[model samples]
Target chain A: MKNFHLDRRQLSVPYLIYLVLFVVMPLLVVLYYGFTDDDGNISFTNFIVFFTNSKTMGTLVYSLAIAVIVTVICLLLAYPVAYILAKGKYARKHSFLMIFVLPMWINFTLRITALKEILTMLEGNLAYHPFLNTVICMVYDFLPFMIMPLFNALTKLDSSIIEAGYDLGATFPQVLKSIILPLTVPGIISGITMVFLPAMTNYVVLDMVYNSTYIMGSLIGSYFSSYDWNNGSIISAILLMFIGFFAIFTERILNRGEKEEQRI
Target chain B: MEKTKTIIKMNNVRKSFDGKINVIENLSLDINEGEFVTLLGPSGCGKTTILRMIGGFDKPTEGEILLDGSDISMLAPNERPVNTVFQKYALFPHLNVYDNIAFGLKLKQLTKAEIDRKVSEVLELVDLEGFEKRSITTLSGGQQQRIAIARAVVNEPRVLLLDESLSALDYKMRKEMQLELKSMHKRLGITFIFVTHDQEEALTMSDKIVVLADGKVQQVGTPEEIYNEPANVFVADFIGESNIFNGVMTGKMKAAFAGTEFNCVDDYETGKKIEAVIRPEDVTVVKPGEGQLNGEVTSTDFKGTFYITFVQCGQYEMEVHCLENYRPGETVGLHVLPDNIHIIPYDTSINNFEGMIDGFVDGKGLFIVFRDFSMFVDAHRLYPDSSVSRGRLIGQDGEHIDYQGKKVMASFQPEDGDMSDDAKKGDIVGNIVSFYYIGDHYSYTIRTDNEIDYVVDDEDLWNYGDKVSVILPKKKMKYRLLEEQKQEVAD
Candidate 1:
């Protein structure tokens, strides 16, 4: 039994290595930097500075607002596309799926650069505003990520279940609300994650598109680039904590969904 | 108990996939409001297509389908008053049992308490009371199947279509589920149209069986009618084990076979061709000369409860199933009583002799006449000395005729009969092409030099490519004509 336990532990070695290298080490660095002074002495002054600063507080609030905006936009764009892909009677479903997935194949930086070019063209020639350009870029960059998971969930659903709903005297609108919407929660959660997290920390797209927007990611990047290592690391640690909390929360939601699925 | 009248009527329904080829043709059926009807047939016979049409998942290309006396051929599946239990039991995998069952009710804007009550009731109906809180994926195959059933029944649709719903279950579970479904049908009193290729299940559970073949309804009746009185040869063969024989009508209500005459109740005129069918269990074996057919026992199979005997009487071979045991090489008399025999018009298009035959020369002086060949000469043999002549055979149509009414005769030497008469006029020296051991005896296929195939069965096994002479008995040879041939009686 001891040897069997050892074999099982050995089988998990690669995952353990990955967790230690990426997750644990990064978190330890963030924690260490979060409480360290300018001279590298262990202190709580850096955290105090982070919490007391009004600019940091405003950046945190701005980050949350941007995350919510990105999530709502993703949901709006993805739901109908996913529904059509799931139930469309077209003969070329695979080809349409390929078209939806094609945008994801390009490098993220390249796609953001392309979006920046399009935004610059719109502002230059079409007189498009800055805030609108930011929204467009964020939605465009993360649309495929939002669509893929939602499409998978919707397509995998049993169509007969919908028919059963109709047979039971449920109208069309009611089916969409009760059956299609609630059943796609996992995909919706995943899609929110796909859009929210990236849009929160993506300073590159904001830098190219927005002027004088002082977003949280922009503030962090500016601090790091100006060589204020202590302030930058403290801000980075704060952002890391926010992301960690939500990641764990999202993981818990997913695990609960899975358990509920198994129980049914 | 409230008894509802007929709710769904399919009138002259026809479905064709390619516009030219009909998958289901002119099918008319009615389902009583609370009765369970099963559409049973082999694969590709359009049984499921019929069910789908009734469910409104598929629309008939021609004709009308009505639900509660209202035509629903144009309605979508969701608009129809029916729910379908697909073969795969397409249950919602993402939802728990309660949510899955309550999904439909919730769609109707029902109160939460009412939805919960209905879900619980259906859960109890399928005997999965505690399963309401269980995840659908965690359930066993049988449990999941029950959940699917519960999900459909909770809505209380007017008609429930089960397309081979019990097929996915294991044997033991299938038997249990069949009983459960029957009781559920009794309790719910809803119209149920079940589709399955399993005849036994259709026989055991359904109030009516609709037998389909080649996209057409072969017969529709109660289980007893389909089992006892089949409408046609296909129905008879498909429903049970039947020994079918091809015979010609000699007189009204009388048929002759293997030198014995039997009384058959058929409405056809005298001298009409017909095919007779008798179930294996209906035939009784007796002493050789006393029964309708006399033949040697080519083979016998001992099946634990009874014996299945195969007898070769002249040109016809038949199977006789009895409780008494009989052995091979024994001469057995087979009796098919008049009540046991069912005669129908022969469809010669489907059944025809397409084989070769080979036999040894038992006697040399046997005369042979080729019924198909009218003006033919033999070059390889000598003629007989006693009035050796080639004569134009005279008949009612006259001598030297060209059509089917003509006959010809050729005489040969008796001493050279081993070579001349060994190969009869209709018989060709053929090589044994193949042989199959079908339990009792070996059935052989012989390929003649004339490119004709003959199927001949004997207890004696022959090897492939073995050359042998064959004789076609004149009395055994019968022409399959488009119309009956008039026979002249000599006075």
Candidate 2:
């Protein structure tokens, strides 16, 4: 009874326990299996097999290319919608981001399947547009992720800054280049992170739409389903390492311009 | 000295938004080149709207805006040769000081070396020579304000618009910026259109000020002209501290106001109504029997260099700014020089009321009925039918005529109405619900028990919860018969 007060340290106990049970333990087990071989001997057999196999290496390169392409396309498509929705007049009457949000409320599989049916019916077959169909489904699934962050960023921007640019003799193109796009960098980075990182491994879109191409997620899935724990764990371990590096790498580049200066 | 040409002219410009009430009414103005102008008014007076129109951010709804004798109303803001320093010093948060100042210069065809030289030159002009590399967010508010100014001035536009740019700084910082901005205007020799609601700032910095109210230009003149010879009561009240009284001409170069008659310089028709404006600084304080009126000192406030002493005479409270100080309850006499008294002819904006002629009284007056009270007046004074005198409405054929329930429109100037502490002396009684002091006189709105209000201008101060009576004299009123309406609309 004397110690019944809920302090800040005590408040985080449940979160710490959840982290250990769900995140740390699974990561450790995967690492152990990924680094060791049969008979429980520690070895580099899984890494050697993964890196040496041309098919597996080729899948990684292919997945990277698809992720990059989808992210660029999604950004180019979502920016205009987000900017228009964030303006004062249009934002008051309707939250246009709900256009993306409503589709997201439906089950992901059903939405993707519906999109696949439309694309297949239009193109006559999914085989003819394996890369195109895969790219479309990936962008369709991740378009909402791109728009929400950009909208949030654009709305928080002070309209007076843009006006100041125009007042300072900047044309429309110059304002977009120097004032508007630079201000929304935080949202753009987050949108890219949310879209690109997940697009790299979303093999479900490929399997449902084309079934003719392979991505990192399907490669990991196939190896694990065949009871090949070492190879599957190695693939998962490589991906986890890649995500960890990519996040820090992106942050470093974003903050690179803000060098320390002597305060006057 | 040569007369500078007109740089900008707004011809019959009317601005409204989305079918709403107009923010700026039909306004025409001229801005001369190399002159510093200030659009001065209170909040929502369309001072900022005028600046926006000049900067090409807003377009006139019905008129042409000419820049240097050409129509530039449809040009974009970037295409116009004028720039604005927004109220909050809208500096780009991402850019450093040097880049922000050079933002405008880069839009032209200047080389990199020339842009650098011009940026440094303008930075020197704003006295922030070494702050070019500093980030905008790290600088103080006053510094950001300087950068915002530097950015616009670097472009060397024909005109510079400042939208309350110094209001964000502290009191001391704002004062310093005021002087700095004045000097900057001197060196640049450009047309500066500064917008501010602060009357003191306008008086201190502007060469000419255009006072605005109710979407209309109230007066436009140099600071001294606007202060000494205001066109109307609104200009007099808005520009400086002045005692505004509803005056009536008594004789040539003579008017009576604030319950006393005084000599003035301007001559109007005898019995012509006017507004007499006398600044507090022009009022001389003297001993009780030495001046035109005697009053008891009600209060004295010690300003830095002088004292503002308020004296309550018979009914008017006189404000005097003098070096001499007096204690409360002291008796003092206030006098104004004849030349110092500015007389402005009154406009016909008055309070109109509806009343009905009930009947006639025996040699006293005809009975008149109103919503709040009723009064008696002789019918011949208003409607001269020649036979309506002697308290009798005898027609020309010697037949007795009935004059009851006849509608008439009665109107009086707000100052013509008087108030009395005694309820029996007035035609109606009401409580003084609210009142505002228009520098010298108190404008009071009295609400009667029936929820009717009478707005009267009195010089005396009344305490809270005091019930007073309103007296509207028939001699000071004009009445018109509503014969063409065919039906009584007084009710």
Question: Which candidate has the highest lDDT of all?
Answer: 2
- Per-residue error (Å), model 2, residue B426: 22
- TM-scores for every candidate against the unseen true structure: 0.72, 0.81
- All candidates: DockQ: 0.26, 0.37
lDDT of 1 by residue, A1-264 (tens): 555456777989999999999999987887776678778899888778778888887777777777788779888988898889887766677689889889888887788778777667656832346556666777888888899889987886777677656655567787787777877788888888888888887767666765456677888778878877677778888787878888898888788767756654
Models, CA RMSD each? 11.8, 7.7
Q: Which stretches of model 2 miss by more than 4 angstroms?
A: A1-12, A88-94, A97-100, A113-130, A207-212, A253-264, B350-491
Q: Per-residue lDDT for B1-491 in model 2, tens only?
A: 88879999999989988756778889999999988899998788899988988887788887888998999988888999998999988788878898888888877878999999998899899888988798887887888899999998999999999999988889999999999999999999989999999999999999999999757899999989888998987788777888877779999899998888999999999999887888999999988888888999999999999999998887677788999889999988888999999998976654566788887777666788878877777667665663754557776676676667888777776678899999998878999865656546687767777656677778899854579998876688877777656456765
Whole-model lDDT, candidate 2? Answer: 0.85
Q: lDDT of each model, Cα atoms only?
A: 0.73, 0.85
Per-residue lDDT over A140-190 for candidate 2, one digit per residue giving the tens place of the 0 to 100 score: 999999999889878878777888888878888999999999888878988
Candidate 1 per-residue lDDT, tens place, B1-491, comes to 56648798889999987565778989898787788899988887999999888777677999999888999998876777688787877777667789888866766678998998898899889998877788778888898888888878888888888989999899999999999999999999888899999988988899888999768898999898888777876677677677765567888788765456788776677777675777889889999887888888888889898888888887567788988877788897888778777877755342123211111122232223342222222211212221212443223444332223323233221112221124454345777755544323454555565544455555566687777554444333433213325555433
Candidate 2 has which clashing residue pairs, if any?
B366-B377
